[model samples]
Target: MSPLFPDLALPVPPDRPALRFGDRSLTYADLAAAAGALAPRLRDAGRVAVWATPTLETAVGVVAALLAGVPAVPLNPKSGDSELGHIVRDSAPTLILTAPGTELPAALGDLARLDVEDVDAAPGRGAPYAVEDVPDTAPALVVYTSGTTGPPKGAVIPRRAVATTLDALADAWQWTGDDVLVHALPLFHVHGLILGILGPMRRGGSVRHLGRFATEGVARELNAGATMLFGVPTMYHRIAEALPTDPDLAKALAGARLLVSGSAALPVHDHERIAAATGRRVIERYGMTETLMNTSVRADGEPRAGTVGVPLPGVELRLVEDDGTPLTAYDGESVGEIQVRGPNLFTEYLNRPDATAAAFTADGWFRTGDMAVRDPDGYVRIVGRKATDLIKSGGYKIGAGEIENALLEHPAVKEAAVTGAPDPDLGERVVAWIVPADPGARPTPDELAAHVAARLAPHKRPRTVHYLGSLPRNDMGKIMKRALKTDD
Candidate 1:
């Protein structure tokens, strides 16, 4: 088994920066030495709760966890006290690590606390404790759900599974030691843990954290020099909107070897607009918390506008109807639920055996809970979530993405979300919530209906549309259709 941390750190020049947070830069040697120094402190704790949002602390905590054999649970620092208390109770962490001002949840206030700013707090009692190295199959990290559907469920990820995901990303994206990854996503989600950090670190590449997002800061980083960039659709959209006409920003973004978008479905128009703004297509991939990313758009070939490309080398994908029978072929046009079986699939929901059992097929394929269809060319386009997002009306199915895509085509529309709202006559009615570009340039309901009718079938067009300042989105940029439905 390969040691999670390379013994000698990355082979980059000692003075060369491997991590950057605004003006701060840490060389490869510094990170390695810091990780080594922090290792014993973590080892003493046995279990650590890192309540820091995506930052250098996350990267350091993760690296320290691997080195010390302590299991790390990363929580959203901004989570409310009640939610934080629930997480603390569920995970039962031995020690809490946080920045000076982090509010402690009532339940965890009495636990031993380690101040993050004082990295040297752990004394140098240098005798290394013998630890049974965690096998690849042993649990490494526990990530909780976003609590969109209900209370967050902790999902335990095995070390092997994490490594498998990293390996798959490396193989598919051709990441190497020479690549530098600049990440602007939250570490609480799988996107940051596996895609943003592990994928690059496993390949011996240097990974940099943005701490907090500012388009100008990102532009400055790109201008300063970064080979790769990864972010969600929201981050990209913000950056695209803020610096629309800056040629220098455009050039810096276009110069990256690769730019990736995932964690949520990127609307087709948003995807295209970003590509036009920056000369490279933002490669969209498909993944969920249960399965770390398993598919991606090709680096060299034509990236289709509405589809995420084929499965990675070691991943197996199967589409099934509601009855759970696999579809015959990838015709790309037939929509069905996407089922995945891969080396990277998570072990189970922490302490929830029944839910875990129900999540998998009898034969072991994970029930992704996401519906998608494949084209004749084998490209995959995700329909909305099965239970909440997809709308059905008069025996016809409608996808949020499809209507959102159409609405985005209108110059006045900034963002849109479509959902099946309740109705007495139709089984369900298509409802749209939109953000308009011009305050007074809102489309009338008839105009909006006619706008979608021109491009879509009668059943597919939204019957009701509402103009809003913004659509409610989660941290990862996925529209909360359920919340919208609840609001009505």
Candidate 2:
């Protein structure tokens, strides 16, 4: 493939903005001068850890590492000591790059540090980078993703995977250099770093990062010529809540070219509310860390609420039975495990060959462990993870995502999550965890059961209901159902 970023190497308009974090911003020339100067410092350094704090330095550090043909591991700033320690030891980087004033956790205190501010961004300070030095098979990043056992596994992502995923998304989203994207997502994970930041740079476009998410900040940027907005379901939910009181937010949202949501299934209720107020439907996409991006609702196609559109270009996707046979009939009801094979797939789990080997089939398709069903028109609607989402109660298999979406439609329900728990008669019964819109007049369990039963079938209704002040969520705003199930 061509260079990861063609424009970064050659000279561009010095005044053209490339990255902005709050009050600090970097133009195209400034980015190249800084990343290019620091690229040589990372040339001999083995895998390096970037103290990812959603700042300009973190972005420049990762880019310099990529330019130097070395694997960069992004460390989450909010990680606890135990979780942080595990990643540092597992990745074993020789260097850690941080912003000038940021103090790293004790887990990374031992690594040799290179503060980006200390580096001189003088033009022609270092030898220019050769794209051929990094081949398609060369490992570009070792991104850590959560797992059940031990700690989060570092997925070794190759240059080809990054190149192809971005190219495919460009075709899918009609993304171009003219598009200016805005988001406030953290810099640690794929959703933020890869898609949110790097995707813009690769397209030779500019990105404006909200130091943190707020409806007012989103409106300010979107109203100021930003065409696209990327966010998770929680951010979108907040937008839906503020739409009535904030007409400026609604006007800004309606004026944008695209508003995309991911990392979880956005409840259909939020989707409807946003569209009703803005007259613009927020699109949903499906992907995982190991697989950079699998599918997205096409920019020109119908913006269906729940479905994450079709498989992205160059990605081969299929729903498989437990016996490993691909499901043929797409009747919009048959549920199966999702298996995908593509150049976009990560190389392996860092230092775990056994887990890597088990993740794939004999034929080479990677088992996603995500349960989903395909509509007759080929839209894929993910129900939930196979481990936590599928509920086989009373001899029928049901998807928690669908039931949760239904519950959110209730006037009293503010937030909802559905899970399967052990039952006496039914092998596993559906349980609902709800955050009511009104605490004083919360919907009764029987009322909720009846409401769900009337909308869906009787078997799909929750067997029990529990009210909560709010649901526990991860940094990406995904509901932690595992925490809910174990009461952790």
Candidate 3:
């Protein structure tokens, strides 16, 4: 009902910075002026494309589109030609907004392009457009999901979803305008763009983008008054490895009000390492493209190492069996597919009626393909994806994440991914793809299996082990278990 960002409309000090990327920065006045100048150009457009780079221009472009009540489709700058072409053809945006001199790939050749900096150069152009009052149900963003199985589907996120999600996170994280957020995540994804950037804007806070994620960059910003840090597992892994040798990095992390990790599961090993060195526990949360944010470890609550805390405000979560029957008790052993209904849920998968229908139950809950278990206190621990992580072996269902965590505890196991492979007697066998901690002194398959059996139940132990130099991963540092070979 209210404006998504109330602070942007009200005049603040002309010198107070609202957003920063590397050395470049924009004050609230500068942002208001730039966005005001750009909104009019996009006023009549049905939909526009943003070359979502981790730059100030991309931020300004998206904000301007929102201000004008036009749906913005954020195109990932790193996507391949075919992927980019599919998105362009599917979305069919009227104009492409990009930074000055950005050399777009051949896929965007047919689209009209406008440099975002043009508005900044000619501030107060075309009589200062007033911000439109967009309805809560109006489509604000068309974010594409990672098309692992097929071409990416655009998730049509409404303005209310954004407003409600951020406000809920504000309550969960104790977020306020005084808190400065910092991250270097790619801007196209919901975690980076919606939460990392817009979350700060909604709270009337500032965000410092590092241009790229580096421990030095994070330390530098945090040391200079940044209050919170958001990162993926890879970034935190590096920080955990560096903290032993880097006091400045440790101190910087220790000084922060909160350290949050998302987009994938952060290993318990890395979590313990960071906490041991910095006396700060990294919080983990779970959500997907279709759901902006479902659950998070609260700032005011216990900083549990592995669980993703409780369901966020306005989110109703339930775990269901394979037959779609809801589980009642949360004794921590029963695992089920997570289905959620909330204001955070996306309206639909754009143009895919069948997919939109299939994604939700007849009753309105969005079926998240993620499988997880709940603690007695409602903390959700994601085991893995339903297709890959849930293994039925010898009549016992096992979650790959717990086994992977167990393998990671071994001194000789540097990295691990678990999956179910076809077996003759057992319906499926637990298989571990491991990277040895010491190349010359690699742990044997038997030793690794026993290590897991000791920590977890023997039924959940890896039936087979394969050693690899490293596990294949996506840009988000999530292990691509589907890509791993199971032939041997």
- Candidate 3 C-alpha lDDT tens digits along 395-473: 9879899898888889898899999999999999999999998888999989988999999988988888888999899
**Model 3 lDDT on a 0 to 1 scale:** 0.91
Better of 2 and 3 by lDDT: 3
Candidate 3 has which clashing residue pairs, if any? none
Candidate 2 C-alpha lDDT tens digits along 271-298: 9999999999999888999999999999
**What is the per-residue lDDT of model 1 for residues 328-431, given as tens digits with 9 covering 90 to 100?**
87775566888999888888887789889999999999998888888776678988888876677887667777878888888888888888888788889998
How do these models rank on TM-score, best leading? Answer: 3, 2, 1
Best of the candidates, lDDT: 3
lDDT of 1 at 264: 82
The C-alpha RMSD in Å for every predicted model, in order, reads 2.8, 1.7, 1.4
How much is the lDDT of residue 29 in candidate 1?
60
What's the distance in Å from true for residue 162, model 3?
Answer: 0.4
Candidate 1, position 104, lDDT: 68
**Candidate 1 global lDDT:** 0.75
Better of 1 and 3 by lDDT: 3
